[model samples]
Target: MQFDRKDKNDATLLDLYTQLLYPRMVEEKMLILLRQGRIGKWFSGIGQEAIAVGSALAMKETEYILPMHRNLGVFTARDIPLKKLMAQWQGKISGFTKGRDRSFHFGTQEYKIIGMISHLGPQMAIADGIALADLIADKKQATLVFTGEGATSEGDFHEAINVASVWNLPVIFLIENNGYGLSTPINEQFKCKDLVDRAAGYGIEGVQIDGNNILEVYDTLSDLAEKMRKDPKPVLVECLTFRMRGHEEASGTKYVPQELFDLWAQKDPVKCFEEYLLEQRILTPESIAEIKADFKAGIEQEVEAAFLEEEPVADTATEMQDMYAPHPYQPVEPNQQSAEIRYIDAITDALKIGMQKHNNLVLMGQDIAEYGGAFKITDGFVDLFGKARVRNTPICESAIVGAGLGLSINGYKAVVEMQFADFVTCGFNQIVNNLAKTHYRWGEKADVVVRMPTGAGTGAGPFHSQSNEAWFTKTPGLKIVYPAFPFDAKGLLLSAIEDPNPVLFFEHKYLYRSLSGQVPIGEYTLEIGKANLIKEGEQLSIITYGLGVHWALSYLDEHPEINATLLDLRSLQPWDKEAVAAAVKKTGRVLILHEDTLSSGFGAELSAWIAEHCFEQLDAPVMRCASSDTAIPMSKVLEESFLAKSRLKESIDKLMAY
Candidate 1:
């Protein structure tokens, strides 16, 4: 154990032998497996092992490590079981995701590691949020998130680091500047001398080190990790390493120059360290060979056993449960003398209630603190909950949601305001890909509520007024709650904040004041998937949500003879299938309507469902009324014509006549 190391650990640099060997062995084995048609794809950290192993060893086991796709050394350093790792590579049901996913896209709570998705930049923000969660809870722990120099080009990288800097979060933004981002060279990426130099823009400490020197990385990070406990803040560390292999095993490196490759090959971190250890007389040749043999033997045994494990069978009955894991609805009878408030006010009330009940509840968005948000939904949240809880962020949707995801996984319920639902496009990657798939990928909980102000009625135009529920309806793991009234807005928000999954709460901008109801004054969580059967009838059934539900009511009031059942489908995903089936079966004819454009709207899916399941009871073809298949025009006349009452009336008349 004798070695030249000044790390916080009592252990010497020799302890990293196993950590260094593991990822290299895994890379070799994965390449073999890929050739044998056993594994799909592999991104090898062939030259960057020192960065991963050293940084991971530098931090405590309690601290979190959010790894990138190529950070296999992090998993190795974390001491993840060889058998489980092999099983994951083999895509066995015994793996982290139950063989539902493959590759480096799985993580578990036990390891304090977050799995990597394809987009690496967003994880930086998630790391920020996890660090923020601990900071708010008075916990002393930091987060280490890794990425390649290529990821620095992403907007999320800037957004994430900026937020980390602003909050002084205990996060280590590590960049493996591996010369090339997949295939594009570093010169094509940025003008900065070193990637760490970008840290100056965020007003954080920037340091570049010889990543091949494992002792240097270990000592630096170990000391930094200790300092973070006392004074938490972000540190940008650039590990000047090389990706010896291509982006993936199959992506050959013809674009790399032979001379540069030869130079780096001579400076291989593992080979260099092994030579140094031998020179220092730490571990003899026989001991090093023995250690290598043990790693190889264990890897061979695990790979063989994992290869023989039974494949995951598709039991859709259980597999489908990953789409929406709703919190079980506890029957909450609202107390008497409950105050009634406007829909917008009720939103604030729900946030207050959520914060009061759960100290872990947090809110983040642009203009959400001092200005109280673009719509003032979080008017007093900052004052009441304090700046740490209710944070005002720059206009970075992806970072907000990404950090929200981080907060949720770290025992905090995070509410992210999208400012405008239309702008959700900015954070679409975080919300749809990561947030929607976290649970399904690794069985990880993502308790995030993305509050989106949706719909067009006040001439807010396409950018501000979009019924984007259809966008998320297509995503599997997200629960879409479009509250049509004040009571549902408050109750469903409470439920959303309480739910153990990511929920997209769409509050209709037009209905913010146009619709109101007697909301319960006390804490109450309404059932998420259940629809409010606004009006019951026998002739025609109208399935709608959000502002469409109100429009249906207006039409029903004007034409009593239509004999319609207005179903306010509050939750779009994990929708009340039983209620919808019964309602459609009872009414024979169904009309699906929404404020979103007709083409590919949720109404299309509803129409198809009715045609598929309730065709036997149907006397007429299902009718659908929606805004025309065009952008919501800025002109009031054009917008009105696009979503006119006449469209609904015509559709109803045809259904009745049929």
Candidate 2:
């Protein structure tokens, strides 16, 4: 049954049958293990093996493939070691994600495969990003992404496809029409006759084929992949198939119609392909029996080896080791020669420096290219870096953020600008779930910088003005920095760009043109996790960040005899706890300040930390100065009343008096 080099070249019948049968046999063995309670769960791809196997075999190994839970054949056809894959399913330490994730939820860079997240459609945009990286490098590589018919209804699917079509990226959107998404039927999933018909809405080529037929899937994808490498463009392919088994073994198939099951049973891909191979003399009944015996024996051996491997232990050191990629603090002092620039101009200078230094760095946001962004921060960037590097993206924040993660996966850095900080809620999932967890989940570097234009003093309404740093501060694996002065703004931004993890840079919109300082004309990066002591004193400590730092300095300037120390914590996630503790110990009384709502603000966390760590050193109880709990108002008078400035002086006076 072994094929020689000559047979491998022309014996498509034998080659495909082996490829298709491998996953089928592997899944059959896995089901046995599942029943024995050896593995936790399994997403059975028993009936639709041909789709994954054929597609994977036809594509080039250098190209990238993004697969979902049901695409087990894709892994098997790529010849991933069965022992390691079984170890992954068994939650062993030898697994790709080291038991952090289960099933096909992890990707391996060596295999050029990026795994899908539970949120179905985001991988589509990620594929667009991978293809974009290749297009930018002028490499003839195409990316293939998979999704279910049900996921096509998601906004991510539409946004990703539209972007791919408009940009002409070399991506193939493969929809495995498996009839049911969990329990929901196709009738409820979409109204169109076929999923491929939706491709026309995105203005792309569309095709539908019998997914059960391995020959058809292989032939069609191979041609399309070649064409894409030579001439990059997006294409949608719908593989018409059925889920012969329950979604998972635990989920019974009782909800499906018996007649539908009976009809699909007759067209079983494995049985149909076997008949064709037998009729063409490509495989004899005895030869098939021999192959099955060989496959079973090999699979059982691998499974046994995987079971003997050690399970992942939940040790504190192991758990916290890779929460974020290691980024050591490297401080570059500001140059002696400097020029006074606004906060917005400092941000622009930092970006220009980063772009000039790293050729693979890319900038993406709405109206960022020609219109120069809403705040004109990137006004002349497109002319300097060209449209490919300084690109304007659609208003779909979720997709763009996911695309940034994709770009990072391919060794390219991306900076995504959110016009208004409050609008980041639209991309919350990608930021917290995907970008923040990429490194901890699978050891993938998420070198993405999200520039958030934040704060609220412009009377720009509640929607436009919000201090939402607390939202991301709660999420682990993200670095948050809010700089008040132009010097700090330029330096911290440059450091964030180089950090090998996701960093959120919050720029106060009110200080964009209002605040100016002597910034270093050349490249420089300040330490991210260090606190800056703007003013030093004795009796009390005023701890704050962003615009609050400015407020505290002004308050201290107004009362020179107050004798209070001011500490500006530029970074939130890895705040300078050592500096804050030292300052609190020096000054018996401490006051925490922020523009966010008083209830459950970041100040609360700082107060709790101070109370826990610096409690014995304090002469008075920890105090907090923050805005009211109500939403920011549109009217200037209401906004003035809503902000924390009105209460800042009172809180500081009370603290110093204590």
Candidate with maximal TM-score = 2
lDDT of each: 0.85, 0.90
Mark the regions of model 1 whose C-alpha exceeds 4 Å error after superposition: 1-11, 32-40
lDDT of 2 by residue, 1-658 (tens): 1122223433777878888898898898888878988777889987888889889988889888999988988998888999999988888999999889878888899898899889988888888888889999999988999999989999999989988998899999999998999999999888889899988998999999888888778888888999999999999999988998888999979889999889888777888888877877878999999998999899989989999999888887867768899877777777889998999999999999999999999999999999999999999888899999999998889888888888888779999999899989988988998888888888988999999999999999889999999999988889999998999999999999999899999999999999998998898999888899887789899999999998888888898889988999999988999999998998989999999999999999999999999999999999999999999998999999999998998998898778
**Candidate 1 global TM-score:** 0.96
lDDT, candidate 1, equals 0.85
Give the range where candidate 2 is weakest over 10 consecutive residues by summed lDDT: 1-10
Give the alpha carbon lDDT tens digit for every residue of 1-658 in model 1. 1235553332365687667767887788878878988778887888888899999998899889998877888887888887888788767889898887777788789999987788778888889889999999879887899888999999999999998999999999898889998889999999878888898888999989888777778878887888887899999999888888888878989999999889998778888878877786777889888988888888899888887887898988777786666467776666676676788988988888898999888888888998898888888777788998889888888888999999988989899998899999999999888999888888878999999988898987878878888888988888899988888898899888888899999998887776667877788878888998888899989899888887888878877777778888999986888888888888988888888889999989988888898889888898888889888888999889987354998888888889
Clashes of each: 0, 0
The CA lDDT at 512 in model 1 is 76
Per-model TM against the reference:
0.96, 0.98
